[model samples]
Target: MIQATELRLGNYVNLNDGSEHDKIRQISGIEHKIVYTLIKGCRFAQVHQSFDRIYPIPLTEEIIIKCGFERSEYNDYRHPILFGTLTLYEGVAELHISDMYSVWVNNLHQLQNLYFALTGEELEVKI
Candidate 1:
């Protein structure tokens, strides 16, 4: 199992668009999977222009492991599939991953462009 601290920021792409402008807020989970939240309103005008509810985006084990998060840690908290949740904060908006697909590619995109952004060598996602 990979340590959470060992996981560094990697290639992140704004799944909403082809832009690379999403700020990762925090990562939390039990073990095998981790939950990644984005700062509200970090996307381009076009992407945020039509925003409505806030929900968590789930990612697959392949993507999470590839990003350097230890999947074995949260085996107990692992959800079968991707799911989203709507959260309201100070009348603003927030997203939370209630399940795994939240990290997939529905609300946000993978940071494939930022892959090399990490200081270490390229790490490939296991299929």
Candidate 2:
């Protein structure tokens, strides 16, 4: 199975007006469709059940080194925003990352960095 950690933040291609500014809210099990929430509210959310499409963003080598995977420790939970993704379920939706292999490592690292950068915290996931 493809792991979610292999996906990078940049890998997400927003089908909404061809932008990558949206964040994933949930994923669906039956269809494996990814649900995203826009950083800026859009009227489309009211009319569409799912966005046009979701695509993967590529990861870079520098990101991999910076966002290396480490096992989660109990203390990590104290910082919810840092590791919120691990605990929360995206409601009825499930999160989806592309199955592509070329950018997996780089993407994972970038994703880690993005999370830390945005929340001002680090993530500790099993390597």
Best by lDDT: 2
State each model's CA lDDT, in order: 0.32, 0.33
35-92 in candidate 2: lDDT tens per residue? 4333334433421223344433333322222334222442111233433322112221
Instruction: Estimate candidate 2's RMSD in Å.
Output: 13.5
What value of lDDT does candidate 2 attain over all alpha carbons? 0.33
Candidate 1 error regions (>4 Å): 1-58, 66-68, 75-109
Model 1's TM-score against the true structure: 0.22
Once superposed on the true structure, which residue ranges of model 2 sit more than 4 Å away at CA? Answer: 1-16, 19-34, 38-52, 65-106, 109-127
Error of 2 at 56 (Å): 1.1
Tell me, by TM-score, which candidate is best: 2
Give candidate 1's total backbone clashes: 25
The 10 consecutive residues of candidate 2 with the worst lDDT sum are 87-96
